[model samples]
Target: MVMTKRQIFVVFMVLVLLVALVCASHVTINEEEEADRILQLPGQPKVSFQQYSGYVTVNHVAGRALFYWLTEADHNPLSKPLVIWLNGGPGCSSVAYGASEEIGPFRINNTASGLYYNKFSWNTVANLLFLETPAGVGFSYSNQSSDLFNSGDRRTAKDSLEFLLRWLDRFPRYNQREVYITGESYAGHYVPQLAKEIMMYNKHSKHPINLKGIMVGNAVTDNYYDNLGTVTYWWSHAMISDKTYRQLINTCDFTHQKESNECDSVYSYAMDQEFGNIDQYNIYAPPCNKSDGSKATRQTMRLPHRPHQTFRQMSGYDPCTEKYAEIYYNRPDVQKALHANITKIPYKWTACSEVLNRNWKDTDVSILPIYREMIAGGLRIWVFSGDVDSVVPVTATRYSLAQLKLETKIPWYPWYVKKQVGGWTEVYEGLTFATVRGAGHEVPLFKPRAALLLFKSFIRGEPLPKS
Candidate 1:
């Protein structure tokens, strides 16, 4: 039967509805991703928090924001270090970790095990501000769905700078503080670019932000080095076989010069040699292994057993911890705080390993130039990595850093605390790189003591304690 255009339109609409139902059921965590909206801070400390509300219109999209916990040091009225914290997931909430977990005013009590003071908290030493950035990560929101969709390193940094302008106006007191931007994970890219933007704005504006220094942990500053470093980290931890290591190197191009497909093939082949499941450290999807008795069964059956330890600990590795962070993230309010939402959507508290696979965009921003500019402008920069992070392995960080051929005066040396050594530090062309012992991507979570000391030294503009 011949049909009119109107009849065809109705038929097409029906077909679209059917497909929508099927895809909606398959809507994964990434698609359902929404920011953890801030209601109120649960506890009280000797801190002041005025929710900084601001709007940044980017590409005609207006983003609403909330920043928490602002204070001025007692003696340093005119000047003090202003620190900004960012949590990386490309879609994760900074308020979740920066505020509640790592280094804000208070920590959420998870179990009956009594209240745990975030002893390694960064706020004790600096004026810390936790921002839920971009349009959709946390308490920050936008009516524009496009604002929620695409993101990359560049856009995130730009949005953050804009957010700060509104934030500074909301709380104008701390504008003169020596600003230092710091964060972990994907923030490797976030911190440097924001620092650069602040400096760029300072050049033109009258009341410029007195920017000082920047810090990042287990940073994803460089993609190539971080990727190759993953294999080295896996091998050190004994997660992979020597045969697998050889296979990885042979298959993958560590240079990071080639397309991602070529690198994926190498990583994919090495993963196939082991259990047929996704290797979270390396981004390659898992292959099926029949003899391994299915991943779920092996995982369930291995419950009461201890997995074989692979990597030999370096000189100062603490056996007791290294596993404490995994234990900490599993608690309930920690879950609630991380997943707090204004809109009704299911939110999981744990960090998403395959974050980019979600609706989040690969930020097209290049932060290397930012880092270079910061160095040129005499702003001190520190990039630290926790040795045990699988997500953004320290080894991969080393690879990423190799791209910056800053003239090296000294080889890597150990940074110390009291009489005990904390981690290694490398100095090249006015930039500092340090490693925190027994920590992961989130430096404060696993090794708060070291993390605190690191910031204390940073705020003082002192060389990190020498070993």
Candidate 2:
């Protein structure tokens, strides 16, 4: 049937847009850009920027490799710096938690059947690289089988450096680019150690990483302070009874390398009082169960491997994100599109790896010295906290920073985002600190706009917006 002039014009415009979209989405990874290119994600929306997902082999002997997802900047491809993100469980997938849940370009739609654009994606300003590190975490794995048992802070740093060097070899254009290490939770350990390794790498090379800065959100800087702050936060927030609180302080040793039986008992009592029904990660968040007794259950990937830790707590406001991501990633089409699980690893993909967490070799190392060293080297360091987090609360971070005893360059003050107070901030001689007022452990997931403002400020080396 022949169409009218108006119909023809509309159809022509539609075809033009489709053509433009194909052109925009068809980002050619130059011949030098190695690894698998993402044709498209299963439920992705039409986007202008390109995304690549695949693995980088860090160890040839152990057949060890790490998975990464790279999302290029929205506008400038060549001019933007690369920011690498890691999420810490000592065993978490940066792609699942950081990329999909927090700051990536697309967030899983509520139905888990499609995608939606994140208004506050970190990719607005720079290229974002999310890595699932230490082999055996997320889609990253090792063929040699013995790798997981040896997982430790030092080993993770070494492998991460190796992965970076090899990955940079593939994307050679980023050689002259300034790279920043950014992560949260245990990445408090990962970021500083990796940066230290990069610093060492720079000493031996002419064309180095051009390492610029680091931004950590609610990071675990010191064990003693972190532990002390947790119990203190619980008591102050009225989550625990005064009796249990007093007993915890009197009987428990927060700084103990390994908690004694007595200490564990006291802590267990405290936890029983407050954490049974509430989400420990975010104290105020609702549990899987309710007073009405309706259950909001999460599904698991439950790979054939020995059961370890539950891959929970990545979601911020959405209580069911763990279930959603598990379902989305497990789809066969999604895996093929992303070039994932080609090796047919024995287990289903999980957001957090229990095996890695159980095998984690170092938990007592205080990273305060790493901070001191970074500060002394004139690196741009910033630490922000999500005020409502119980896992690694803002109080813990403040106490950890206090251990630094750095000279104060600026006193504490409220910082704003879009005329609203985002949180408070304080700047030391070599570091800047800020907090997200009402956010939980996963700040960006809960407060995207404020988190983006915080990130933009961090990336620009400016203070958090103070209007």
Candidate 3:
């Protein structure tokens, strides 16, 4: 067929435009993909799922960035829900603890030689995102040193919410996926605060986050209830001496804004008595054999104990996983594979940064009010406690939940796993409370199978298996 010169010219221009569009789309995809891709870790096992680690700048002016590690679901990544897991140190590394140790698809083996598929990995049904939040925690950092000093609850939530929204631009696939924020310890504060931020944003946002629910384990939800329940647990468990208990009752005021001199002295003595030789996170569990010891006892300071050790889930994971993680993360090849420490961080990458913890400011004393608000907003909330965790024990969680005073939707009952009792569960209108039979501060680490069952039931909005 013969065509006129004008027709040929028009066809040529259309083809050029199509090519340009395709090239632009390719650039966008590859830019986001290559920046976060993980080829392989030093000793990681081959996996069907894709994993990514990189920084998302939260504050460009301050050069502050948060690090995230995301592992897609092995079977159907696109269909899986997105779970963003944060570790609670106010200064902890979620990637180091949550991703590498507890609920990640693979737990860094004790020797750090290779990875093995975690039989109970949460990612089996969800895309799990582990974030080392706040500047100066793990590999996340800031150029302005003052940013670290100003870190706290409000700032953390703002930064995290911004990080999530900004992150959506990079991985648009998850922009509309349902988001479930889960964490333990200080994350009790982080998760709810972040969830509240999302809820607030939803009020004004045209493109809102698809926030569905939240889960927290051994969380620090309230100052009064948390402390009241903690001291009561310590005394009831025979952890502190009778005299010390008496002193705690008479001299210590858990409701006090700051500990009095007498309370400080008594509390120090009680802590030393209970936690000196073992893990306070799990009273019955053995101490970490790797680290020297908690900073409380390291010096001769008679001051009250400070928060230390983001080495979480110590009860279920290898007490020495911290040591293995240190060995693995510090390897040059491993960092290169993960695309970490690109700016040549000044210090070695520690699992938890004391600087971040020390510099934290504006942290909430309690998150109870936020919990009330979120629950009233019809957001699903689940609070689970590890029975054996003395730091934030089942007792403390029960006391906190009691404050909600929500009548039981489902009466407390034993939930079974594999024909054996895994734990007891209580359902409330806005919440579900469960206890891992003998798990420690970190439930998944110690009771992986049971933890998985709990998570599965949670996403499905089902009651724990009674039979």
Ranking by lDDT: 3, 2, 1
Error of 1 at 91 (Å): 1.1
lDDT of 1 by residue, 1-467 (tens): 99999999999999999999877654632232222233333333343332322233343435344334343333443455678888765655565567655676555453322234455566567666777666566445555556555655667778788877766654555667678888887677678878878888989999888888888887766544565677777777777788777766676654442335655665555455563344332222232233355432111000000111111122232221212222343445433444433343243323222233155455422356667788889998888888766667777767667667798855688887767778888877868788886665566755677888888877776667776
Q: What C-alpha lDDT values do all the predictions have?
A: 0.59, 0.80, 0.81
Q: Whose TM-score is greatest here?
A: 3
**Candidate 3 residue lDDT tens string, 1-467:** 99899999999999999999999986896788678988777667788999888989999999999888889998999999999999876676787778877899877877777677787889998999898888888888899988877887888999999899888878988888999999998898899999999999999999999999999999887777777788788888888888887887788667644688988788788776654565667677666543455422110101012332323334335676666777788888888888899998888887777777666667676688898999988999999998887777777788878888898899989999999999999999999999998788878888889999999999998999999
Residue 70's lDDT within candidate 2 is: 92
Model 2 over residues 33-105: C-alpha lDDT tens digits? 5346786887788898888888888888889989888999998978998999998877778877899889999
Q: How accurate locally is residue 26 in candidate 3, as Cα lDDT from 0 to 100? A: 69
**CA shift of 113, model 3, Å:** 3.2
**Per-prediction TM-score:** 0.70, 0.88, 0.91
Clash count for candidate 1 is 12
lDDT of 3 at 108: 80
Considering TM-score, which of the candidate structures 1 and 3 is the better prediction for this target?
Answer: 3
**Worst window of 10 by summed lDDT in candidate 1:** 297-306
TM-score of 3: 0.91
Q: Regarding lDDT, does 2 or 3 come out ahead?
A: 3
Displacement of residue 133 (Cα, Å) in model 2 is 0.6
